[model samples]
Target: MALYDVLLALDPSPVVALNRAAAVAMRDGPEAGLALLEELAGARRLRDYHPYLLARADLLHRLGRLPEAAEAYRAALAAAGSEPERTHLRRRLAALAEAGHEV
Candidate 1:
């Protein structure tokens, strides 16, 4: 199948968007992936999705938007329903704080 067709087929799937955003980040740049995440956030589609918020936080961190990245990580932690996920988010948050970020 064509790339566009495959993407279209997975358009309704959040996992697809998340992975696609990651791919875009790798292929184009963090800015492009961030744009997609922002769009998803604005739509309130992935507000409670840990991976979505995590991806946003990582992108913000890469862009040097440390404050926003911290916020995103916290949000992801809050929405994380699994203990392991919470632990991971906490680790990420701690790393950011240790980096002198105002988390």
Candidate 2:
């Protein structure tokens, strides 16, 4: 987490911020991470980045915001650059659906 903080302080790029958000999620809570992710919503670099969307989905899912998480997961699935990533996002969505939250 300290490493992420240093990286952010040095770069402060959207991607760096995204990674920092993940660290924040681990060290703090999903709410803290989600707040950081929300601050990056207007970042053009994240618009088509599956990682950013995936992070949002994961945080929202942790927060029990199933519908919103499902939406973000779908978006991440669509933007995924690899088959493995798509499969992961699909599993996440499927889990949400099994929990009675339809995407």
Candidate 3:
């Protein structure tokens, strides 16, 4: 985590930021991770990055923030470059919807 912190300070690369966010989430909490992901979501460079959306969806799902998770999953589905990722995200979204949520 400290290594990622130093790397981010020097580079601030989005991938590094995402990795750090995952580290923070693991060390702090899903909420902390989701917060950093939310901040990263505002960056234009990540607008079409399905990985960001997928990360957010995963964290949100872990935190029981189902509505937001479903939305993020949908965004990831839309941006996914491959059919497999889209199919997986669709399954997750469908599971959420079946759980009595309007996903």
Candidate No. with top TM-score: 2
Clashing pairs in 1: none
Give one digit per residue, the lDDT tens place, for model 2 in 1-103: 8898888899989999999999999989999999999999999999989889999999999999999999999999999999999899888988998988888
Best by lDDT: 2
Give one digit per residue, the lDDT tens place, for model 1 in 1-103: 2473498585766667777778888778999999977767754667687788889989998999999999998998998889999999899889988999888
Q: Lowest-lDDT window of 10 residues in candidate 2? A: 94-103
**Model 1: ten consecutive residues of lowest lDDT:** 1-10
In candidate 1, which residue ranges exceed 4 Å CA deviation?
A: 1-5, 13-15
The lDDT-based order of candidates, best leading, equals: 2, 3, 1
lDDT of 3 by residue, 11-83 (tens): 9989889989999999999999999988887788788898888889999999998998898899999999999
Alpha-carbon error at 37 in model 2, in Å? 0.4
TM-scores, all candidates, are: 0.83, 0.93, 0.92
Q: Could you tell me how far off, in angstroms, the CA of residue 81 lies in candidate 3 after the best superposition?
A: 1.1
Report, for every candidate in turn, its global Cα lDDT versus the true structure: 0.83, 0.93, 0.91
Clashes of each: 0, 0, 0
